[model samples]
Target: MAGPPQQAEGSGSAQASGSSTARKTFELNNDVQVADPSDSLFAYSRDEERVLEDAAPWKKDPHYFHTVKISAVALIKMVTHARSGGAYEIMGVMYGKVRDGVFWIMDAAALPVQGTETRVNAGNEAFEYMVNFQTANNEVGKDEMLRGWYHSHPGYGCWLSGIDVNTQMTNQSFNDPYLAVVIDPNRTVSAGKVEIGAFRTFPEGYEAPQTSQYQSIPMDKIEDFGVHANSYYPLKVEIYKTRLDEQLLDLLWNKYWVATLSQSLISSNRAYATSQLADLGAKLHSAPLDASAKLKKKDEGVEDDATPLNQATQDSVRINTELQNGMTAQVIKEKLFNGKLDAEGARKAVLGVL
Candidate 1:
């Protein structure tokens, strides 16, 4: 299958994009700062001529945008909120400015909105809260503009849902140069990496080129993933940080190390694991155990991604890998926290797990 549409290549605005390789997760890296002090046109916190308020280039061309570079603090905050949501959904808005088709996500703050009990109504009050939030931000001098929104899917996977496509469409209608980001916290834990995707809906009546980028989604949600996969496309996401951001992360690594050693992510997310197994069983009932089975009949001129022999094979591989990863986490918890193994032994086992 063809992959998602790639960024236009070679120089000019395309040169502003990062590596073509997809980012599995955010990691602090030692790279040169984006802004150079000697050059005088850049600030550590701001980019030169970053905001293009006059022209809506993206409106003229849907493919104009290609990448999203989130700051260290922004990504940290997003994943933290996403994980906190656990099995339920949590939503937030991002703070950034657009330049050269990239969303420079500087910071993220959680909204009171969620798809669970205790979710604050996103009424006029939600707008009121955002205004107050921005007021507080301005007071502290972190006055970045809103560029996009982020939400968690919990376990389903990082793809836009029907509701998500409509929401993003409305946002794009009013908020050009906007983005919708999804984070799958449950998969992130199992994969030992951030499960994330950034997307923008196609304009109405616009026939987007057919492309597909596979995500290791839950078996139960595979249909939903397939049906809505074409409504929008994923952006090539990258992360950036200032030199001070790198220094702070290094200083905090010790704290994170201690926490990682003690926390059992699997134990905490047992509900998700149970649901995963249930989904696997449901998928197995509908899938052929024999991947080599030949189809008896097929619809003419209609391409079906699922229900084919190859799809069954791929699904089995994903299912087996999912269960294996879950078992590894369980073992890690047992050996590390349940007194089944010594600390050194457990630590060594965790190296491959993480």
Candidate 2:
């Protein structure tokens, strides 16, 4: 799919022709600072000239203009999910903070969904995954707020469909600063570059001034579609990089190079299965041998005949098992504090005696 439509020239002027409302500027109070232009750690640069005041003509009536900044890791995750879906469409939710008019995307989670060429539905496990995600991330002093959603267009270009517009409208109504991002995975892979679009919907009953350059849609696809496909204004996206992201990119390059040489999905899966089976077989074989040895010792009336090496091995196993149990108890306690498990459940989980 092609990416979202680019903003036209002169579209950023805050003052629309004959408009009476004044442009408003907001200052953010959070720690989400804009990276310095001279910073070498960041991979992408923001277009300082493209402010919300200069939004597309269709979005002039919105109360405030919004800018979207995606973290390097978040952008990578989104693109990875899109590429994994291949020709099928995939959907996911974005986690971030909305400071002033700026939306910073900190992370993303791919929802459980089965997608076809045109539509993707959140799968049965999606709700459970979302609940777990919220519980794990929404800690004090954390910037992991639910911000918006994203999906892929596969072979189609990145313009919003009528259904997508409706979804965006509902999201914006409930979540101010909510954004909808569309990625064209096919284009990204083929072009060896990311192809994506960020957009915000206009308010209800808002009409755009007619333009001579606008083209009419064919009758079959236009029914009930209204101006939805054209109503959204594109938001400039900046993928800000961090030091950790640079390290991850270096590791990824090595992994991708290795993958290119001998990696096929089927072969990798088969190897994993074979390794697991071998481990299971080893455990199964050793268990019977140990039992038979114990039976023989009982028959010979040899009690407590462990050698020094065997005693040490037994001690090591017991210590390791106790350490695992302690870690499991700690995890249960944290889950209780996070309200993922009730007190009674936590008690049972941590102390079997309860």
Candidate 3:
């Protein structure tokens, strides 16, 4: 995992052959924009570079030649994770030569882990981790932030599926530019045979997708380089736990108890009010309840004298209760027919069952 492959780039040029594509260039000067700047999921820093973790020969699908930059460490991590029968995740750093309209992946790195079933959904946790990594190392605001994400498609080939598009859309919708990478675990083999494809959620009005064949990365030649040996092995304990905790916290904050509890409370209150209103209406219509009201009033001789606050509170409760019992008015000529309901519409909508 610590060595480099002899070949680089999409061309068949080997490092030993002295081809320009084989030479590693670390110069930083470009726009490096993400696929969607409005996305909230990930930000891109076209300038940041992560450590390459492998020495294996890497190949890219021809279609993605201008779209991604596979760094030495990023490629090694991918091979190591693929070799272990586990899912791998990539923090893809992007580079865009604004004049050429093409995107390059300048850096790709991952936190390796072992698990029975690997989930590689690129969510906020991954974003925060990469962002923090950049910040702690004083690399924040260098060039790009969080560009995109890469994950293995397991035994699946290097093509984006409908589900894959949907998942990537989830990533892209985060108001940041992001792309999804699919590596064919089964297709990755000795030397230069690894197949990889990159994708981004295209904007509206784009042409429909083509599903005829697998998208394949081109192989120019085989070469060797350097990698971090530890990246090729199982991830260390601290890194694994740290990533796991971040993911767990993100899930809890975004998904669990608080949101559910608030929604539940609103629903329960609406239901209770509806039930109370129905019971009150039924009691008014019943002969027995009618008799009790008269008798109780006469016996107590109180004339139901309640204070203004108490009476007002009762009226408010009854109105809300009636609303819960399905009381509503129609809109006429684009105007609300009921002024009371219209004035309180916002409050009522929030209070009512949704």
- Count of backbone clashes, every candidate in sequence: 0, 6, 41
Q: If the candidates were sorted by their TM-score against the true structure, best first, what order would they fall in?
A: 1, 2, 3
Better of 2 and 3 by TM-score: 2
Candidate 3 matches the true fold with a TM-score of 0.36
Q: In model 3, where do residues sit more than 4 Å from their true spots?
A: 1-66, 85-99, 111-119, 122-125, 140-143, 190-192, 204-206, 209-211, 214-354
Off by over 4 Å in 2: 1-63, 123-125, 139-143, 209-227, 247-354
Ranking by lDDT: 1, 2, 3
Candidate 3 displacement at residue 240 in angstroms: 30
Error of 3 at 21 (Å): 17
Those runs of model 1 whose alpha carbons end farther than 4 Å from true positions after fitting are 1-51, 117-121, 288-354
| Candidate No. with top TM-score | 1
Q: Per-residue CA lDDT of candidate 2, range 220-337, in tens?
A: 3334334565477777777766655545655454334333322232332343334333533444444555667777887999864543234334434533453454455445544544
Local distance difference test values of all predictions, in order:
0.70, 0.60, 0.39
Of candidate 3, the 10-residue stretch with the lowest lDDT total is: 221-230
lDDT of 1 by residue, 64-178 (tens): 8899888777898999999898767888889887777877788899987757621222556667888899899989987777788898888777888777788889889987778
